[model samples]
Target: MFTIHAVDGYIETLYLAVYEDRVLLIDSGCRSDVPRIEEVMKRRLNRPMSQIALAVASHTHPDHAGGAPTLRKRHAIPVAAPKDINQWYAGFSGGLQHKIDIMLGHFVAWTLKYPFEMIYYKKHLLYDHPLKEGDRLPGFEDWQVIETPGHTSHDVVLYHAETQTLYAADVILKVGSGYRPPFPVSMKKEMRESIEKLRHLDVKHLLMAHGGPQQVTDFPAIVDAMLKEIDKGLPPGLKRFRKLERFSPVMKRYYRERRQAKKAS
Candidate 1:
């Protein structure tokens, strides 16, 4: 039997899919979350660090892809992520945005009343495998990847057909009885389209990075609710962060490239 344990990460909930022999991290947590993951696997799972065979980064954001490289270095665990995941933080703007993302991670922590901690990590992503949509996670074939862009230029959610669980990364967030699209909605149209794609899936459970895990009676209703929030755009308190993020070089370039791609397609 495969048991999925939700580890309390520094900022987000870390999902660890464990088996008798090996383990898989549904979404690698923040950089500072490295030690925490290690501890959980050792003490809770009673497995050595090497048992963590693969760590998948569902997106390039700080809380999603931050701890992957370090986990690989520390335990030689292979890192897998979406195609072009690195491009989101590729050039000069990416560098600045990366630092800004680190600060934002801290800012998010602050907003959540989380005590201070180091959230820094290398700006660039280093993954052993580049996963395209529909590619089964390198070793864990039971899980399949679904391209769900919009929260960023590149985002993906893993779906387990048998279990009907969608590991929605930053693509969806549930906070205090509410569900909404991730911050910065870097690509609003795409985000909605991505959510639309998810709406069609037979997902009975949503495993979110932020909202812990949840059971679903009406998944489409939840998706529709989130899509509505996306359409409504950022609320008053979030408008500033959205503006700041959109002003970043990364977002500017993402916008230009998306515009051109739309025109071409």
Candidate 2:
């Protein structure tokens, strides 16, 4: 049996996938989340911290990777990240809005998790393993890494063929009554292409970083709807407003659902 734990953080969710005696942690939240992560591992999985054989950061965003260094140091786990994660960590080489969004994201994370340990806020983490397209992640049979860049230049999604599950980090998000990227998309084109790629996969369940698992009865339909929204692109101001309006409440519900889903699963 495979068990998944979703832990809510300041603005993101951390996922723990336990299969047999191995545990794979996906996306360490803010620095403040380490203690809770360790607790969950011990209490829920009945495993020591050292059993977290692998840790992966879906992207280089602070909400996703801020706690990686601390987790790595504390448990001596190898971190697998995109090869270009360092460049995105430094700062996305996009337009002015993209740069502004990156800065704003950092500010918000720091503000929400103030007095956090400074070591967790490092701009870049030293990845022990660098992943590329088509590579099978070690210790995960039938789980292939898919490079789904767009939300960030180094965003990746993991596809477990055996379970038909897609660990979609931030490539797709579920908002109120609809789905869209959260905010400040750097490359709309690449994002659309990534979604197209997912459309071809045999995905039955979507385990998103920002929401609970969704049964994909009609994934193509979902992708079509999302693409239609992408086709009618919203202006930057409107996009930001919509995102802000949905951020807190929607994420709160997602956190709750994530906990419930983990228990039920």
Candidate 3:
């Protein structure tokens, strides 16, 4: 049996699956997270850095993949990431509108929280192996990689049918008692389809990158809510505001405070 460790980071969580005196790291956190990750390895897992046989980046997002380059360079660990990561690694790709949307949402939000990390992401870090659906992760024979793109075109989720565990990555995020997609879903239709795929799975444990572990029972209602939103397309004004929320740190803080106040009330 492998032990799973959730290493908390600035705004992301890195998962480590340990088995047979070796570790498989999922999502390497940000640029500055290496030392903390090492600390977790030495103190918590009682393992050396060399025991990290393989590392997988759930997607190309900085929080998930920023430490990948360091892992590769320092530990010489092999990394498996989405093939399409190169498209957005350097910067944005696709149509002007698409680029603008992502820059306003994901890019701006990341920069607001981790400026130097963002710079490191764009300038450094080269993804190693390209993973896709049906690919079995090395050292984790039971866990099967499944494409779960929505947050990003390259997002993938890991499923272990024997254990009924789903390493959902950012596909399903825990919000209070329920789950939801992270803000500024770039491909709504694809995201919905991915959620539908997960809905059919006989998952008992739903593990996420951002939120820690969640109950599978909490997923159905969240999926239903997301499907309802997908059916009702975003209004132009609301879309604009969502993008603006990413760009303006003040707006983000205001919304956060407002939500907290509402919950308190």
Candidate 4:
């Protein structure tokens, strides 16, 4: 059996699944978090960087995929990512969206009163394995990857059926005692459908990128709460973040079509 270690990243909580001989990175954190991950492996775990067998990018977001290729280069770790991840930032518009996402990462840092740090990363990743729903993570077969595309079209979450624990990348966000959908619900309907898929899973522990891990009693209730928050949408005070989120091509087209449809009506 392996243990999970939490690495406090610049704007997210990164998880490392530690086995006796190898390690599995649940989600590759921001570019700025690479050294931090290496330090944790060396100092805390007392393990060589070579022990890191695989790094999984749940999505192509800066925080979720930025450090993956770096780890592969520095430690010879292979990255397992969504099959369509590279498409997120494929062209010129995608490149602009990538930069905007990075800026939003910094904006989140500023909102949390955290000090400045570099989080820039390349848009395209040299992924070794492309994952799909129900496929087990490469080199970490015990954990299963579930596609949960709402925050992003390529988002995924890992499920450990043995322990009923879920590594919910950015599917659900927590603040104090509350839970909410991620900032940019790029595909709202798909997000809801993805969350519904999760609701049917037998999950006892939930590990979140934004809020960290927590024990779940009634997983369905938690999911219901998250869905409610999504329905409520972002409040007026946080509307600026939504504006920034629209920079994504998917989000831009989503809103643009909505506006056009509203005007037609």
User: How many residue pairs clash in model 3?
Assistant: 0
Per-residue CA lDDT of candidate 4, range 150-260, in tens? Answer: 888889999999989999989988988998898788788899999999998898989999899898999999889988988898867778666555555665676798899
What is every candidate's alpha-carbon RMSD to the true fold?
A: 2.2, 11.4, 9.9, 2.1
Worst 10 residues of 4 by lDDT: 243-252
What lDDT is obtained when candidate 1 is compared to the true structure? 0.86
lDDT of 1 by residue, 75-118 (tens): 89999998888777777877777888888899989988999987
* Pairs of residues clashing in candidate 1: none
Model 2 C-alpha lDDT per residue in residues 22-41, reported as the tens digit of each score: 88887777666788888888
User: Cα deviation in Å at residue 227, candidate 1?
Assistant: 1.1
User: Candidate 1: where are CA atoms >4 Å away?
Assistant: 247-250, 257-265
Which lDDT tens digits does candidate 3 get at residues 1-265?
A: 6867888765667788888878888777776678878999999978899999888888765567777888889989888887766554342222333335434435544754754333144423476677888888876777799998766667898888887888888777765655557655656667899888877778877778767876665556666876776666554645765553232232244458768999999
The deviation in Å at residue 174 for candidate 4 is 0.7
Lowest lDDT sum, 10 consecutive residues, model 2, at: 243-252
Each candidate's TM vs. the true structure?
A: 0.94, 0.79, 0.77, 0.93
Off by over 4 Å in 3: 90-119, 123-125, 229-265
Sequence-dependent TM-score of model 4: 0.93
Off-target runs (Cα >4 Å) in candidate 2 are 91-103, 106-120, 235-265
CA-lDDT, candidates in order:
0.86, 0.73, 0.70, 0.88
